[model samples]
Target: MATYVLVAGAWHGSWCWVEVARMLEAAGHRVLTPNLLGTEAEDEPETTEPLHRWAEQIAEIVRQEVDEVVLVGHSRAGLVISEVAERVPEKIDLLVYLAAYLLQDGQTLNDWAQRAHNADAMTNAVAFHSDGTCTIKPEILEKIFCNRTSAHFIDFARARTVPEPIAAFMSPIQISHERFSSVRLGYIECLQDQAIPLDMQKAMQAPFPNVMTEKLDCDHSPFFSMPHELVSALERFRRAE
Candidate 1:
């Protein structure tokens, strides 16, 4: 059985991966979904922790939890996994970016977002807080992140969502081909995604010529909209490796 570390994206906690983790566990694979700092609380105070702190938290979990792991990053967490791989490459067998932001070395999420075709809409939708944090308005959350998902799941997510620290988005990721690109990379694209459009996902992935790509006929929140398919895709990726 393979071990997997499922990392959630900005404004989300490990709770987002519950259904997917359960499915993976049922298939005899081990999975760990660690909540990034500040995400555990629905109303956590604006945080000062840089993006590296989030990566360190994940690296610590990787060092202590499993011998080796298939690190899966969802949404914004694509950057997080890259940073974690830099910190502990030997502990990660493969890096999976699930409709996530796959950034280049020294590129911040802001930089990537600005280059995206949907940049104007995404930027306009964000409600920035005075404390260097930001969040999507609840009214638009469903449309943006869970458009194809059921109402029940969208409601649950909205209730659990928290403010994401802006510092994390602004902090550029520090990675290198030697430390980060050595691990196998896979990308699962959500075809109907509105949060991270299909074009943007492909653009983010273009630089990584060796990355294996898979597609799902779902929206951004595949863990809720199509957990079984997501699990199947992940298993197929693992087998290919």
Candidate 2:
């Protein structure tokens, strides 16, 4: 069984991947979904810590487990996973971006978002909180997270989302060619994603021309709207290796 480390995006915790994790585990693939530093309720604001500290958390997971892992990053988790790959490239077999960000060497998530802006599409969207933490307003959670989800799941998601750290989105990515360039990359597109938008997803894929790509006709949060399809895609990709 292949080992998979699933890192969640901003404003979300390991809770976001509970169903996905179950499916992978049922299929006998060990899955590890670590809650990023500031994304958990108990992880009090350490807005001062640099991104490398987050990357180190991921690297330590690899160091404790098998040498290499199939690293999967969803949404803003992409930034953290990429940084982890930079520090421990040897510990990653494949890097999967699940309708996620793919920032350039010096780019921040906001920089990428600016290029994909659509005021009409963003009408229901909200960014940043009073404390400078970022979060989607609960009213727009359905549109942003799982537009097609059952009302039950939508409510669960809205309640679970934490206020994301602005630093995580605004910080410039630091990558080392000696590490990142050697790993294989893959991308998944959430076709109905209003949060990132379809156009932005395509743009994110442009940088990794050779990366394997898969399209899901679902919203930004597929674990709720299309869990089976999402799990199937992940399983297929893992076995393809």
Candidate 3:
């Protein structure tokens, strides 16, 4: 069975992957959904640690696996998984970007977000805090992220949503061709995404070499909106590899 390391995006913890993890586990694949630093609680402010530290935390988890891992990152975590692959390239079987920001070397999430058509709307929907973190406004969570998801799932996400570290978004990732290029990459695009924008997702997938691409006709949160489809796509990608 393949080992899957699932990473959540900004303002999310391992809780966001519960359904997906369950589905994968039922299929006999080992799945890990670790909570990133500063995302364990809604009240915790963003830590001052650099992005590499967060990447190291994830790398530490992957190091425990006995076999190579299928590393999956959601939303802003596309950067985290990329850095993890750089740190532990030998441990990764494939890198999957689930509607995430697949940034290149020296690029920051802020750089790509600025080019998105809904940047203004997404920025305005956030409540910036004094502690260099921000939370999405509750009133617009359904409109922006869960527009196509069920009410129960949307409410579940809204309740668990937390403030996300801004430093991670501002920090530029450093990936080397020698280290990161060897890992197999894949991208899952959410066609109806409002937060990242469909066009920007396509742009991010443009640079990867021999990357597999799949399209989900859902909003930004496909795990909640279309868990079965997401699981099927992930299975197909793994089998194809």
Give a tens-digit lDDT track for model 3, residues 155-192.
89988988887888899998999999999888999999
Residue-by-residue lDDT tens digits, candidate 2, 1-241 = 8899998876788998899999889988888988877777877754765466788888899878865799999988888888988988887888888988877798888787766766445534667566767667788788667777889888888888887767776788888777787888888899988778888888877876768888899988898889899888776676665
Q: Which of candidates 1 and 2 reaches a greater TM-score?
A: 1
lDDT of each: 0.89, 0.81, 0.89
Model 2 bad stretches (over 4 Å): 119-124
Cα deviation in Å at residue 195, candidate 2? 0.9
Which parts of model 3 are misplaced by more than 4 Å? none
- Candidate number achieving the greatest TM-score relative to the actual structure: 3
User: Best to worst by TM-score, what's the order?
Assistant: 3, 1, 2
Score residue 118 of candidate 2 by CA lDDT.
Answer: 62
Candidate 3 lDDT at 230 equals 99
- When 2 and 3 are scored with lDDT, the better candidate is 3
Distance (Å) between predicted and true CA of 111, model 3?
0.3
